[model samples]
Target: MAATLLFLFVFLSLYGSASCRLLQTPLLDHATTDPIDATQLPTSVEASPAQVQEVANVSRRELGYYTTSCETGNPIDDCWRCNANWESNRKKLAECAIGFGRDAVGGRDGEYYIVTDASDDDPVSPKPGTLRHAVIQSEPLWIIFDSDMNIVLKEELLMNSYKTIDGRGHEVHISHGPCITVQFVSNIIIHGIHVHDCKPAGNAMVRSSPTHYGYRTISDGDGISLFGARDVWVDHVSFARCTDGLFDAIMGSTAITVSNSFFTQHDKVMLLSHSDDYMADKTMQATIAFNHFGEGLVQRMPRCRHGFFEIVNNDYTHWEMYAIGGSADPTINSRGNRYTAPTNPFAKDVTMRMDTPESQWQSWDWHSEGDLFVNGAFFIPSGAGASSNYGKAASIGPKSSSLVGTMTANAGVLMCKAGSPC
Candidate 1:
């Protein structure tokens, strides 16, 4: 254990002078949190002691860690967002994620870095109390907006490790500019922000952190881009009219959860892998749960590549094209979601195996269990049921798809007022 701690100290020292802060994290102690095993959280479909830890017995109200009276929300919303005292205990939101990203504590342990300034005037040396500056700091921090504001980024916001952008208690919109970029970092949480109209801006020098500077290429107008990152959770954000995907996780990123959020007015809503041949993505694992895929969405409600994804309990109310699509050999286990198809009859099929011959793609593991389909919606399951691949039955699992409407009724950035449950 001493040797392991010493190695961690040396490893963090190479990044910057944040070794002291890094050492304080109990998860990094190696003994308590295994990096490889951290991503292996219990799926909704798996029901066995050996399959995954049954934490469902832990009530949503009990796990919220709220200080004051908690409002009665649906089981999922009651986890963190419905508490009247959420702002006082905002850091507790980090504990809300389940599945693969259950362990992403975000910057809960660090000091709060309140964003008093909304302008992203300079990326290289962002002003103190700015969102850009807060993200680049070496120490873990929970970033929050001081007031209701809309921030137009001068450049793409590059995020560092161990950070949480908690946008509760204030209306915050990151729109009409370059959006977020998470690259080669880990343990981040982005909640309760409006992300839209992200125009591309790059091809110049930018500072990703306080200790480093680098030249960056032209960025795609992605709402949130995660590259080579780990343990990320993006929840309760409203995405609309993005130049590219609402959220895209690529390049060996793993241990992620996109839940309790909302997506609308976007093409290619999400892309899990950048390349079909990027073999490193084979190890990727993500959980998509309790979100509302709302109006004006076209395709790729996560067109994925090689990865194991447990998609659960989301409400898909609109789609011009297919709801979920993929190429490469991906494992998609869709469970307990409510898919409400649009009027277009041709785009009714939920599965789209892009660029692959039906004969070849037929063998991929794609299973939809307990999903509620309406308006002629259907999921074309392929492969040998993908049942055994899901490990085991989950006796305590996702709630009924009938309850999805109430479960995700408050989907997206919510109206939060003081002295009231948000």
Candidate 2:
């Protein structure tokens, strides 16, 4: 059991789509009438006791390791990478996640589905072993690639619940294609897949499930779109240039986490909340930790709204405009982060409050503690720096930024070395 859990740890560490470009704005902008009236949005779902204990099991093992080198590295590296028996025990990664998103078990109780084919040929009757076929099936499944693959989709990949796209033992790139769309689903995990250069796909029939087919309008080519979804986790992904937002959580998506990922050459990186007025997102919560916000990123490491958020231990190495921004009263708990700002003195403030007047936004609950600011970078904190306000933030606040380099040294899609730790 100890070995099994440590394997899950590394894979769960770490962290999109394209260009249905123009249409990818805040949902409130397209409210047609009143999106606020949509009262059916989901709230945060607590993990079952069994699931909670599962994460606790991994946490106990994580106490022993913290090096970037696999030899003496922490459990996150041992969980999968350094284990020479990796290929034979690949699925253990599906079990190793933490934070609220740890509830995303992803294809845990289902049979293995190998995507032997990469073509997105027929959505109505997708070819077996193809990614579209695997995700559309109703049963839970652990999906893996047979070999190195570069798949470009015909339209947005609408995923059903209970699925994990494990890309640990191969080089898989889902690029220059329609990216993934997760809407109103639960328990989905996407790990170690290189998603970039995604384009807009829509205006046609697409399959969301084996038994359902629906028409999709033009989509904004976001690398990944989470709309009203619950219990979803995206880890170890490498995001580069994309047409739209790199990662977005909107329309009441809750209990989500984005960790140990790498982002570069993107504008408007991540967005949380549909809009300033999407009050339903007040319940939104996420743990963004151990990620490296690399070069060419302008702002919005996550421009949040409403929601209570935990932005902890992330390495912000580059930003032109700002790092964390939001409006409409977001409770942001920033801790132990390393922010190295660009030379642009005009854009040194790591926090943005939209256009909210200082009198009103000043009262919002935003606090920064133990952050390392370089090159004149600074976080503009407001409200009372009270610990009582960051409710439901990760029970385990992030480790210090002093460990940020090791924690995220292997960020993005890690190399899947065969017969050895990746």
Candidate 3:
């Protein structure tokens, strides 16, 4: 353990200095200063239990040494996590986002809405102070919980626009019920909540806004569903045992970011597109960064379709099947990530081009750069002609994979106190 920790320190010191530019599409230019055309890319290049332990060991060293100050080399967390008055200045978090969802100012211009009630007895006329009521309000709100509570929704909790459901400084669990759904909304941020064991519920009237109530069909029982939504961010949330996808962003949802979260005991962890035929999804763009995909997981750590995706600087510790899978020619740029392949020999490949023949999917631009693999894991890259443009793109680059262990040390729901740094 000591040797591993020492090696990790040396590794970060060597490789952590450079910042790699995030990959971007022609539609989303805000995330990049020098964008590369998706049609041109590099060709194939083939590229762990001790690696997982090394992450934990480095995390332990970080916690033991930095008691007064917090520095995990995670750019988002480093922005506001060190402030002792984070509870009072909670809105500062809204400014710390990076990647494609960098402009998601979720309720930063609104007032605070404290959730004091946990009951979901009615989805239409929800009780004041309940989470359901707060989300349904049409006005922008920064929602926070008054106490630790487990909310079992009577139906899928539909959200309105410009809302930040901040769950820091409390243990808030929304489980054993239908979870959250963001349909046709914009600028939503969900953070620091434990969501699991979600079951499908619908076929009844549900209120999406304060003045409107409408009947809904059966929901897919995802922990969080983003349909036709934009500028959304889900951070520091722990997900497990959801009935369908733990997180599904479909139907033209774009500019989304999922960071600093943990996933376990699930199949089809994330789905990024509506379907193979959804042409409007060509505008979809997302960033999956600084997250930890932990034990007892299967495939599709995002199965994507027509979109541009930046999968960077995350820690993948376990997977029964492949870690990243996609179809329909999505542009996937996987860089500065750490993947520890499971013991199963057949599932050693980290990337899977599902349901597409190599003759067709060979042209898909899936590039892997500066990724670390353990336990005989390898990635199959596919693309057309190469380019030097990747070297010139400018942005807040992803940190080195060497620091991924400590960067994602505190992935899931954070334990935050009222007057202390979270």
* Best model per lDDT: 3
Q: Model 3 — which ten-residue stretch has the worst lDDT?
A: 19-28
lDDT of 1 at 417: 75
Question: Against the hidden true structure, what lDDT does model 3 obtain?
Answer: 0.81
Using all chains and alpha carbons, the TM-scores for the candidates as numbered come to: 0.82, 0.82, 0.86
Q: Write the per-residue lDDT of candidate 1 for residues 304-338, one digit (tens) a residue.
A: 89888777778787788798999997988877777
Candidates sorted on TM-score, descending = 3, 2, 1
Can you write out model 2's per-residue Cα lDDT over 131-227, one digit (the tens) per residue? 9999998999989999999999998999999998988778889889789999999989899998888888889999999889999998888898899
lDDT of each: 0.76, 0.75, 0.81
Q: Model 2: which ten-residue window has the lowest total lDDT?
A: 29-38
Q: Which pairs clash in model 1?
A: 46-393, 46-394, 47-393, 47-394
Give me the displacement of residue 48 in model 2, in angstroms.
45
- Candidate 1: residue 401 Cα off by (Å): 0.8
Candidate that beats the other on TM-score, 2 or 3, i.e. the better one: 3
Q: Which numbered prediction scores highest in TM-score against the true structure?
A: 3
